[model samples]
Target: MNPTTLKLCLMAVLSLVGIGLYGLMICRNLIKMVIVLQILVKAAALGLILAGQMSSQINLGQSLGITVIVADTIVAVVGMALAVQVQRRLGTLDVDALSSLRG
Candidate 1:
């Protein structure tokens, strides 16, 4: 692909990353924030993969992406479980509303 096209794609990825981060920061709901955070993480992984591949380091890029994907899956599953438990116990998933910790 041409450098111009690559630059455009990078810009688009960066824009998505920015929007995801902004949503994560501004969202009051736990689920929305978590989803946005995941998006941000994925965008970062994409950026890393793109950079690595552009450098002719395909193996390195694949390895890095696999690691990130694995970590992301684990984190997302655990976080979702925790969020569900919290919502059930607290009756809401709002961050500010959560204060009492169940022993």
Candidate 2:
């Protein structure tokens, strides 16, 4: 990749991280938090890919990206399922409300 392209990728990764953190801090809804978490995970994968590209280890980067995606998908799915149960049982998805759970 050209220097310009590398710079662009770095900027994108940084922006994604910043946006995800901001969302996580400001959002109270469980679903929104999950979405923000996905953004952070994607940013991490992107950073790994960029590192691989810069290091000329394309295969390693691809494999790592794939693994990250798989793991992130599993986590997101489980989180969503739990969020659904929380909404059903507690009648709310707000973090503040869910914090009231004793167990």
Candidate 3:
């Protein structure tokens, strides 16, 4: 790949990571937080692929990206399930509300 293309891809990865972090920090809803986490994981997968390409190991990068995708999907599913339960029992999806719960 050309240096220019590599730089662009790197910029994209950085942008995604920045946006994901910003969203995670600012969002109070559990579902939105889950979405932000997905964005962060995608950025990580992109970074891994970019590194593999730079190192001339594209296949390894692709395999790692696929693995990340699979793991993230499972995480998202579980997160959504928890969100649903929280909404059902607590009547809200706010993180602050969850903090009031006692064991």
Candidate 4:
């Protein structure tokens, strides 16, 4: 695409990843952590889309993006499952509370 558009796209990806990282480092809620992880995944997908637009191998980039999306979905499902279990066992969804979880 246009050079300006490409720069904007890259900026958007950077901002998205930055937000996710900030959330991950600062948030105490397990659910919020999961949501931030998804945000990072979305940023990755956006980067892949931009890569496809910039390079000659459009199909390759698209396939990689799709793969990332599928992997993210699987991870989200598993993460949510574990979060649910944690909530049930600990009666709280806070990251600080997870420290008390023991086998």
Candidate 5:
């Protein structure tokens, strides 16, 4: 890629990471947290791919990106499942409410 293209890709990756971090910090819902985490992981994967491209190791970058995708999917599924259970048991999706609960 040209210098301009590389710069753009880096900017995109940084934007995604910033947005994800902001969302994670501001959101109180478990489901939304999971979505934010997904965004963060995607940003990481993009960064890995960009690094691979910069290093002339496209295949390595692609494989690592794929691995991140697979792991992220599993995490999302589990997070959603937990959110469902929390909603059913507590009748609220608020993180503050969940934090108050004890064994």
Candidate 6:
């Protein structure tokens, strides 16, 4: 990749990370939090892909990438299940209402 192209890729990945971080910090809904978490993971994966592509070797560290993908999938599944349970039990997805445990 040309220098400019590589720089652009890096910037894009950084921007994605920043956006994900911002959303994670600002969001109060549980589902939005899960989505933001996924966005952060996807940003990391995007950065990895960009770096791999720039190296011209095209090697994605398949073992690690696959492991990460599998783990992410598992995480999303479990998160969805938990979110559903939380919504059912709490009647809302807002994170601020979680003080019942203090009782």
- On lDDT, the stronger of 2 and 4 is 2
Poorly placed runs, candidate 6 (over 4 Å): 61-63, 99-103
Query: Compared with the true structure, what per-residue lDDT tens digits does model 1 show for residues 22-95?
Result: 89778988887878878988887888788887898978988998899889878888888889998998899998
Question: Taking the tens digit of each residue's C-alpha lDDT, what string does model 4 give over 17-68?
Answer: 9999999999998888998999999999999988988996788889999999
lDDT of 3 by residue, 13-67 (tens): 9999999999998999999999999999999999999999999999999999999
lDDT of 5: 0.95
Residues 1-103 of candidate 5: C-alpha lDDT, one tens digit per residue = 8999999999999999999999988999999999999999999999999999999999999999999999999999999999999999989889888776577
TM-score for all predictions?
Answer: 0.86, 0.92, 0.91, 0.92, 0.92, 0.84
TM-score of 2: 0.92
TM-score of 3: 0.91
- From the highest lDDT down, the ranking of the candidates is 3, 5, 2, 4, 1, 6
lDDT, candidate 6, 7-41, per-residue tens: 88789889989999999889999888889888888
Cα-based lDDT for every prediction: 0.85, 0.94, 0.96, 0.92, 0.95, 0.81
Please write out the lDDT profile of model 2 over residues 2-99, one tens digit for every residue. Answer: 99999999999999999999999999999989989999999999999999999999889989999999999999999999999989998999899877
Is 5 or 6 the stronger prediction by TM-score? 5
Q: Which stretches of candidate 3 lie over 4 Å from their true place?
A: 101-103
- Ten contiguous residues minimizing lDDT sum, candidate 1: 94-103
RMSD of each: 3.1, 2.0, 2.0, 2.3, 2.0, 2.3
Clashes in predicted model 6: 0
What's the CA error at residue 100 for candidate 4, in Å? Answer: 3.9
Model 3 lDDT on a 0 to 1 scale? 0.96
TM-score attained by model 1? 0.86
